[model samples]
Target chain A: MQNKMIGYVMILAMLLFGGLSTVQAADGAKATNPEAAKVEKMIADADKARKKAASVEGEWRDVGKMLKKAKAALAKGDYKTAKKLAAKAKSQGEMGYKQAVAQKDLKMPSYLKY
Target chain B: MKHLLKKIAMLAVAGGIAASAQASPEADREAFQNFYKNRFASVPMEEYPNGVYSIDPVGRENWEAIEEFPPYEPFIDEGQAMWEKPFANGKTYKDCFADGPAIAGIYPLWDKKNGMVITLPLALNKCREANGEKPLKYKKGSINDILSYIAYESRGQKTNVIIPKDDPRALAAYEKGKKFYYTRRGQLNFSCANCHLQNAGMNIRADRLGPALGHTTHFPVYRSKWGTVGTLHRRVTGCNKQVRAKPFKAQGEQYRNLEYFLTYMSNGLELNGPGARK
Candidate 1:
């Protein structure tokens, strides 16, 4: 009877672990290609932001290069690197735009003051 | 109550000063001229076209020596030849200018029709295009040579840029140019005035800075560093890069407007281009 109890406990433990492994497999699949659609949206948004900034003559250096590289990485299915570069490019472009706007009403230096 | 009144009085004074500081082209010219004169009491106004050499005795001596056998002489000769040379249409540069003496000083004009500043180089290119010849590059080589000759011929003509009040666009362009002159940009965050105006006659390492008062008087300067003649725009580009800013295209609208603003500031100064400089 004790041996029979031991067999039942083993069966229960196996069932619990087997269910957990299945969930783990699903999580592993999610991790390998996690949020690819979200990363693509981020890249698209960054590209638009950069273009808007450039139209007003507020382009900063390396933003274009970064974007291009990001797109290239995305094409190669390297979503992690692509998303990082795109985000950086977007930030740089936004800063450039802000700078151009601020310069429009720039204060003249005291020496330049009449 | 007394302190508050005092603050109000100070604010009024500040407002008055600010109102005066919105400089008109005419007012700016007068003020800039006075500022330079006051700063360099020893140097004669006419000698300002000599740039840094005017303020530095050692630099002047060296410049004078270079002038004795001016390295730019060959460029002038070459430019004169090109000027006289006929295009495929058998038309010459004289056809473009109507045989006018080199009018370098009267340029960067507000073209009311085109709604743009017509610089000497741009006009030259337009002339070339009309005659079915390819336009020359704006920065260096044969273009620089041609400008050097024109500037040499127009030497002593006073810089007299006009921003006609008839057109609102003209004023806007002038204001834009003025803003650009003062706006700090690039990684270094230096404006054109930082080196040329505020730090004028001061040295940054081995280089002595020139004043902005007569900045536009000379162009197509034969810089030893370049080992060739360079135009005012080229010098401006170099200055922009030195301040870590991305340079605009030579003869682009931004530069043309800047030229217009600077030339206006140098009203009454003589043109002495194709100059030699270190």
Candidate 2:
């Protein structure tokens, strides 16, 4: 009976240690994914785009908001989510700038040509 | 060979004239004025300052009724008091600007020292700040009231904004304002000219889009929708918001420049501001 109880205690200890080690490994992967660097670069690129939009006074409110969210997600170690948000922000910023540049020569009806 | 050369010369001359016509504000103004005059043959030039009311008979009846006991009257009274009241240093608005009626028409002027446009409302705020008082807000309440009085005082004064060729900055500001007027913005993708120029006198839903001609003549308008008088910048902000565009600050450089351009377009039209509108 003594031997059996000792065996059971050792198994319990192993299970507890194994579970903790697995969680740590998962956390490590979450915090230090190989893709994190690529996402960081993408976020930087998106931020540059946002700045370009703002330089021409063409930034929309959503572009800024999305960039903020992207940075927040990045801070939380959610690289995938951060990359997605950053990409969206970048698209919006580029589009806003394009719209402003295109509008530099506005089109009006022939009657309103003056 | 001689005939071909002559044709080329004639073509070049025609192109030059066309380019100059587009480039000259005076030429553009003449064309703009003629467009309105020809379109609304029955309406007199003086009445253009009245805006949509000058064109829409039923709207005019309603507008006249509002004018009989104008809501802006109290604001003008308030403004008169503000203008006459002494500041912290015992200096009044008179010390800042020429004391007389119709002074508002001369505003949105280029300030050589500042290298920027100085609008009447901005000038009023500056006077306050100069006199050791806090400046009034640009779009509402006491500021609008004082502007109302000033506009009322300036009634019948023709807009006469000048862009002195001597100052490159002055022309730059005017050009910026003109670009803004024609530039499409907002999610709706419309320029100021889209509604005011092309669709003037036309109905968009229930409201008539007023002409760009004499648009600046009557400002600080008692818009029935707002149930209070609003400055031209306020109207601009409202228009921008309506189109889903974020507006520049009232009295800011963008707006000041826009006012300069718009007021220049209304040159020779009588100032009829603090007017009633629907």
Candidate 3:
């Protein structure tokens, strides 16, 4: 009887600890989704880039809309879609800012006589 | 010897300043008109008020046919009725604009008191608010109605947008507008000059890009694509969007300044608003 009781105690401990470990692992995943975090960072960068472009009145129409869509994808845990969109938006923002900066001095077109 | 040196230095400085200073509005206008004159040697200066139709012979035939039974006629009639109708405050638009509806040529002017460009649509809205009436939407709706009537009546009045010499701000506004025109924006990275100025009379897909000259003479245009009469700002908004850039608000400082510059370009062109277009 003593041996049987010891065996049952060991099995019970294993089941309890195993179940607890599984729950902990799930909690860990929920708390620290590296992919989600990366996507959020990308979105933040895109927003900063967009604002920089807008500061010079160089913002493209779809950059804002793209950022919004990226955030929505991020909320839905669609990291791939979010990252792709955020990257495009950031690129567009940079392009627009560069475009405006390049024309800082009004270089009237060659065709247009001053 | 020192006095002579100082006078020479002062003369050099003055010459530099004169050279660096942007061409006056009049000079700019002359250059702008001359560009089109040289490009379309066959098309007369007076024919420009007809827009792209002046250059496109085939399109001009269709445009002439459309004009015979003018689509904008009802809008003009509606605008006339609105003009005649009294406001809620027992005042009509005439009360505010004593000069009356034929006053479209006078607009897109510098409002010295406001330190801003005041467009016709904005003036009309102010008139409405002053008379205790609801302001109309800028891009579309009944605003086009009243504007159609005003433009129709104002036909033949020359587009003479004066940037007052007294107010330096007026010239600054024109400069801002000129900058805006040349600046590239949007995903397409196209400036207003890319299509309208650089590629004027060139076909983009099926549509021939119209010349920037006389662009502002016809406003409140009835475009077949729109199927309704829309203001110049409305067309401007569409152009921005076409290039995939965000559009500025109608009558907003940016657009008003743009209108000021654009109208100034069309100076001496006959007012031919409430125009039909494809």
State which candidate has the highest DockQ.
3
**Candidate 3 lDDT, tens digit per residue, B1-278?**
99999999999976654442367778778878888988899998899999999899999999999999999999999999999999987889999899888999898889899899999999999999988888999999999999999999999999889899899999999989987987888888899989887899999999899999888888899999999999999999998998988888888888989999988998899999899999
* Per-residue lDDT over A1-114 for candidate 1, one digit per residue giving the tens place of the 0 to 100 score: 753654465456447786454334323333454565567678788888777766665656567788888866664456789889999988877776777777765565566436
Q: What is the TM-score of chain B in candidate 3?
A: 0.92
Give me the runs in candidate 3 sitting further than 4 Å from their true place. A1-34, B1-21
Order of quality (DockQ): 3, 2, 1
For candidate 1, the C-alpha RMSD (Å) to the true structure equals 11.4
For TM-score, candidate 1 versus 2, the one ahead is 1
List runs of model 1 lying over 4 Å from the truth: A1-92, B1-14, B17-21, B99-101
Better model by DockQ: candidate 2 vs candidate 3: 3
- Reference-based lDDT, residue B73, model 1: 93
Q: What is candidate 2's lDDT per residue for A1-114, written digit by digit as tens?
A: 753654465456547786454334334444556675677678788888877876776665566678778766765457788889999988877876887977655342356444
**Candidate 2: misplaced stretches above 4 Å?**
A1-50, A60-89, A105-109, A112-114, B1-22
Residue B237, candidate 2: C-alpha displacement in angstroms: 1.3
User: What TM-scores result for chain A when each predicted structure is judged separately against the true chain A?
Assistant: 0.64, 0.64, 0.71
- Minimal lDDT window, size 10, model 3 chain B: B13-22
Residue pairs with clashing backbones, model 2: B102-B153, B102-B154
| DockQ (0 to 1) for model 1 | 0.18
